[model samples]
Target: MSCFEILDPAFGRFVLGNAALKQLATGFDWVEGPVWFGDAGCLLFSDIPNDKILRYTPGVGISTYRAPSNYSNGHTRDRQGRLVSCEHGTRRVTRTELDGSITVIADSYQGKSLNSPNDVVVKSDGSIWFTDPHYGIGSNYEGFAADQELPCNVYRIDPDGTIEAVLTDFNCPNGLAFSPDETLLYVADTGRMYQDDPAHIRRFSMESGRPKSLGIFHTIAPGKGDGIRCDMDGNLWSSAGDGVHCIAPDGHLMGKILVPEKVSNICFGGRAKHQLYITATTSLYAITLNRVGAQTP
Candidate 1:
């Protein structure tokens, strides 16, 4: 089978003709949250069901980074180079301090506990945005099953330590990422959790500190978008049932890099951020890309 399905000719520029998707590691229960640490020359990802965070080094292979990670799902580095995480077990967004202590950013809004924090992204101004869905709390696999006290909403934690609900209309918002220039924010709404069909991703324009849904960004044909990241050119690479779907800045289909297993999340790492690391169902995959990923900072 072809390794990629390029919808537009422009998609050809981001991929290599001889680059094949390689499974870096496997045998985990559920793998997600792949983040590259260029400074450490390693990659860290979560195996949610196993409650572990695994690390992969260049010469070395996979090793347990942290066990009992509190079911960390999504991860990204902040402006200060701290790891920001969305924890399902704790139902909160946390920042991994330089000394490795966990600092709670948000747990409850208006005295009501959050449902489950899924994905997170740090903005340029040090504000944190994350999706709080019931995915982690809905079952006993990822986290302890519990009642959802708050509705599934996309929230923003200001630099001043104030929490605000930016958008409260999603059924279960999943992955989220900002555009290369921070002009737009894309969020995935996996309707499967609500038994809804035709799962789609939405793009919101950030002009006045308020986000308004511009419209549907892109719709996956046979799968749903789970985790998404943007390349330097504002091309969004989102996790699909088949693999990762690359969407253009104009919300047009770019192409897909097929993975053997269903992918959950992805991030750009490696020296120049040209390597794409993916977290699939039970494995971790990576491939070198001709184009580099958009810098979150």
Candidate 2:
């Protein structure tokens, strides 16, 4: 029952062996994105099919942060502490300013509408990065269906409002994150669509603040993974069909945290930033861990 046996080697010194998973809330169609707001002391996550964003805290329980959330899929905070979100319904990326107004980041490129904005992350330089897939347009359940007019690609919205395609050739890019040092970028390709053999997570070498080389990082043996994040030590914590998998920075399979439901996304928050908040399908769960997430970089 040692904590080291339950978490990645990088996290062995952090999570207690006996820490128990705590259920926070339930009753949603599907939960996907999760972002922690330390300033507000709450965790915000998406219930995609429900078209809503929900907030959870230790005392107040669950509350609707935003209804009709444009079927948002993924979310993160900019360095300025603004909420940035990826919208499936609109096939665009947006930001919520402090003054409570929405600014569309990217809805189209080269006069073509994006397929679906799935997951998002922001860099220290105010560049917005996101994944575009066809999940939103594959059916009418999560958003309006339409012919996909764009390739499944990763895009970067520069600080000056210029949009640039960062990566392409992905079949289904679902989740993404940067290594603690920002030298490597990891993205999950659920690949549930084409390509009989799909990659779970792919790593790209970053040069001059851009991705220059691409390689397969790790592929889950059975099911798929999504919404990956890194710890202070560079271990990737990814959501899986079974639960959560922690892979070492050296591509070693570390350990896992088991949950009753399929987890879609996760974030670190709480008093010491040691709390791991998980957005499982239809439910939200958390557990105290021994490590802290990598600060946005």
Candidate 3:
């Protein structure tokens, strides 16, 4: 049985035949928000229902990075190499400073409490962008069930501490990433909870730090995309029900990486950034590829 499912001939050059998908860890209710810390040689991810953050090292195995993590769901590193996280329990975005202190990034917009912050990404200019959906507060499984105070929207926090809602038309914005050159922003909308809503990824053109919508980029079938990342070649790797779907820059489905569990999120990590780390329902998986992830810190 082959793990690779080549849908397009172009995907052949991106995968390595010698590479195998390895399950790094398991025994979690749900896992998401994987971020690679190259400086520390570790990968930190959230076990949402468990309310803990787990760290994985190549040889050391899995360990608890942080417990009672406020139900964090997504994470990324800032330009300073600090950890930026989206917390579902607290319904806010936060940053873990180098000195071991936690700083609140954003919790509200225009005096109204925000929904749960799902996924986040940092720009080269130090801006923090994230998606706020009601998923976290909609149930007691992943977070404290509560009423949503604001609409699901995407927001950006400026380096100087000002926060603004950047996009407001998503049914539920889940994952997000930037192109290698930072010219394009790809965001996943997993609003399948509502009948008739299509599960898709939307592309936005970035201009002077603002996004101009380019409409639906691609739609995922067999399940929806919850998290997404981009490789150096501008190919977007998205977490799907069947596994992981690779979409080209022109919005074409290139291929799929089959996994035993449904993938929730992914990040490019490992020494040379040639490895793709995936967070699925109950396990963490990784596979080496011929491509390098887009440079982001």
Candidate 4:
């Protein structure tokens, strides 16, 4: 049986006919973020419910990278190659230094504690962008339940350590990524989990160093968009209930990669950045593609 549901002819060139989707590992409570460390030849990800960050190597299999990781959810590398992460348990965003020290990036805004930090990304200018949602604090499953001190919002941290709420209108800003040239930013709003809101991704143009909304980019069916990433060609690859949806630059569904379980997040990795690493409900999966991920800066 075919592993893909091709919706448009353009998507055919992006996929490899001989490449088979491979399940890398399983037995996690709930896996979310997946980041590639090319220099170390490993993939690091968050197993949220387990309160651990797991690492997967090409030939070494899965191992514990960091246990009791403060229920971290999403991760990315800064331009300097240091790890930047969102910690649900701590309700903060942190950066892991080369010497193994952890630096708190942002935990509060305007003297009030922020909602749990969800997903994160770093721009070429050394700025850190992330989502603050209540999912982690909504229950005791992923993080400690507590009163939300701040509204769910998207934030940006300047290289000088100034914190600002870039977008304030999202019900729940989940995953986000920048376009190839960093001219456009795509953010997923998975507010349907709490109310009768739309489950879609919004596109915004960078104007005056802030995001100017371009309106709803695309809405996901079957399930809401949980995480999203962009390819070098400006295609947005988003996570869905059934699998991963590849949307073209023009806001059209290009194709779908069928997964047996729900996908929470994904990242382009491997030697040439041609391997798409996926973090599903209970397992980690990957498939080779004919595309490369957008380089940082």
> Top lDDT: which candidate number?
4
Tell me the lDDT of candidate 3: 0.92
lDDT of 2 by residue, 144-233 (tens): 989988889989899999998888878888899988788899998887454574667899988887887577888865468788889888
User: What 10-residue stretch in candidate 3 is worst by lDDT?
Assistant: 191-200
Candidate 1: tens digits of C-alpha lDDT, residues 1-297: 668888899889889989888888888999988877888899989999999888999889989888888998998889888888888998999988999998999999999999889999888888899999899998899988999898889999999999999999888899999998999999999963657645789999998877988989888766789999999888899999999999888888889899888889999999999999999999999999998998642
Candidates ranked by lDDT: 4, 3, 1, 2
Off by over 4 Å in 4: none
Q: 1-297, model 3: which lDDT tens digit per residue?
A: 778999999999899888999999999999999999998999999999999999999999999999989999999998889999999888899999999899999999999999999999999888899999899998898999999899899999999999999999999999999999999999999983445776789999999899999999998987898999999889999999999999998998999999999999999999999999999999999999998999563
TM-score preference between candidates 1 and 4, better one: 4
lDDT of 4 by residue, 1-297 (tens): 778889999899999999999999988889999999999999999999999999999998999999989999999999989999999999999999999999999999999998899999998889999999899989999999989888899999999999999999999999999998899999999992458887799999998789999999999878989889999999999999999999999999999999999999999999999999999999999999998998542
Which candidate wins on TM-score? Answer: 4
What overall lDDT goes with each candidate model? 0.89, 0.85, 0.92, 0.93
Query: How many steric overlaps are in each model, in order?
Result: 1, 2, 0, 0
**Clash total of candidate 3:** 0
Residue 120 lDDT (model 3): 93
Error of 4 at 92 (Å): 0.2
Provide the global lDDT of candidate 2 against the true structure: 0.85
